[model samples]
Target: MKTILLKSGYSIPVMGLGTWLMNGRECFDSVLMALENGYRHIDTANAYENEDDIGQAIQTSGINRKELFLTSKVWYQKLRFKDVIDQCHSSLEKLRTDYLDLLLIHWPNKFIPMNETFKAFEKLVEEHLVRSIGVSNFTINHLEEALKSTVLPIAVNQVEFHPFLFQKELYQYCKEKQIVIIAYSPLARGKVFESDLLQKIGQNKDTGPGQVALAWLIKKGLVVIPKSSSEEHIIANLGALSITLSDQESSMIDNISENQRFINPSWSEFDA
Candidate 1:
């Protein structure tokens, strides 16, 4: 597993298993499968409602706590200072861990003050409850405000990133700030299988569209957490690490005409 050094001075696995929209026996099985396979990183969140399942999987795998990297997020509605602290503690209890490798704001809540949320984050870092802190689904404006609101380094910004919905400006902004970008929904929610270009690239590489999409993101120095419940697909997603895309191939993916964003919600302030 390739690792990237975070601004917080911790190394994070570039590839992680994303546990979203999964729960019960299915979540437990998928998480255990990922750990057994070559995965050392796991991503979950309060909203995902599967932290307990992931904790059970970790216990079953018998992997040392120090050997795995776990990430979780606080829901936007819980951005109050006390709520943030309580949420982190609750998440840790549910995950059966003393500390989280990385904690993030699941979404930017315009109604909540950024400094108040970050104050809780700073307290967590001080108390050794969280190793690093970050934000998810934040735009450039939101990031700028976050930067101003905290003294600690913003280690990462996880977002909906893939070839089709490539966020060039936000990517550049984070790079300038030395913030690692984690690509969630890196496969475009299975839309990769529909792209003729990705299919052709996969054929050339003797892999598949999913691998091609993941390889492109990896080649760009971003981390990816692609979710899957299928054992075969989970293992196949890891094969992307071995793929080496040529400049032309990468550029071809860059020139993709689609700019679709699939995960938008009514409360999202994407345009704001």
Candidate 2:
């Protein structure tokens, strides 16, 4: 797998497995398959309520912990400084790991003071519980607020990013700050499977439209995590690494950006 270098000098896999809605034996089996299929990165969260399953897979896979890049988020509800630290410790215990490759604040909520939350993150880094720290679903304004609290740069800001909901402004801002943008819902949550342009591109590449959508994001130099519980879909999603699109083909897909978003939770006000 290709890798991207973060400003922190850590390299992350260009593509990863996302465990958003996955659970039970389904998540365990899928994650094990992903590890066996050469995937080295996995994204999960506290709110997902599947960390125990994910930990079981890792423990059973027998893959060395050093080989995997694991990420988990602190849910918005735990935004208070003290609560953030306590929650992170709980996550580490559930994940069965002493250190996390990356830790992120799941969402920006008005109820929590950004500085207080960030201070907790800084402490985590200082104590060596987290290798890197960042934010998710943050706008430019939210990012600015986070920066004001600490000198440790934001390593990444994950958000809803697909051809239909391309975030050009936020993308540019992250680029200028050297912050990697981890794209969640990179396939538009299966909506891209029906796109005519993606279908045509898939046909030309002799792959599925989902692979085309993933290839498009890979070509744009963004990190993407597409989730699936099926072994067939996991294999097919990994095939995205072998395909590349031309500049014209990429431009054609870029034209399809209509600012469409698929993962809007009730608390979020930012429109991707």
Candidate 3:
């Protein structure tokens, strides 16, 4: 598996298994399948409400904790100092791990003071509960505030990224700040099937539309978590690890006109 080194000096596999809406035995099996299929990174969150299932899967997988780069998030409402610490410990117990490779603030909560949340994170890192820290669904403005206020480096900003929602400006900002941009919904929740450009590229590359979308982002050095329940899909999604996008193909994808976001929760500060 390919890895991206965070500014915090921790390395994360570029491809991860995202568990959003995956529940019960399905979520359990998917995580095991990914790990058994050589996936080294896994992304989950407290908001997903499947951490217990994931915990069961990880414990049974028999993979050593050090071999996996596990990531989980504290929910937006839990950004308060004590809530952040409690959520992480809860996640640790549910995920059946002593520590997490990365812990993220699930979303930006303007009502909570950034200093309090980050101060908690700084303590988490100092105490070795989480090796690296970041935020998800954070806009450039939010990141700017975090970068300015946090004593520890903000290592990642995961968000909805795909051909349809090409966030060029945010991508550039993250690159300049040495922060990794993890692309969630890289397959756009099956929206890649409707993209003519992605389909054409897949055809030329002798692959599928989903693989084309993932390969396009991987080519740009972004991390991606495309969720799946089928072992077939899990293995197939990893095929993008070998697929390469050329300069022209990359630019063509960049030129895609649609900018629709598929996962816009009401509390999401996507436009901020």
Highest TM-score among the candidates is held by which one?
1
Against the true structure, what is each candidate's TM-score?
0.98, 0.97, 0.97
User: Where is the poorest 10-residue window by lDDT in model 1?
Assistant: 263-272
Write down the lDDT of every candidate, Cα atoms only. Answer: 0.95, 0.90, 0.91
lDDT tens per residue, model 2, 69-163 = 99999988888999899989988998899888889999888877888888898899899898888899999988888878777878999999998
lDDT, model 3, position 135:
92
lDDT of 1 by residue, 17-57 (tens): 99999999999999999999989999999999999999999
Cα lDDT, model 2, residue 171:
89
Off by over 4 Å in 1: none
Which lDDT tens digits does candidate 3 get at residues 105-192?
A: 9888888889999999998888989999999989898998999978898999999999889999999999999999999999989889
Candidate numbers sorted by TM-score from highest down:
1, 3, 2
**What global local distance difference test value does model 2 have?**
0.90
Give each prediction's root-mean-square deviation over alpha carbons. Answer: 1.0, 1.5, 1.3
Extract clashing residue pairs from model 1.
none
Under the 3 Å rule for N, CA and C atoms, how many clashes does model 2 have? Answer: 0
Better of 1 and 2 by lDDT: 1
Compare candidates 1 and 2 on TM-score and give the better one.
1
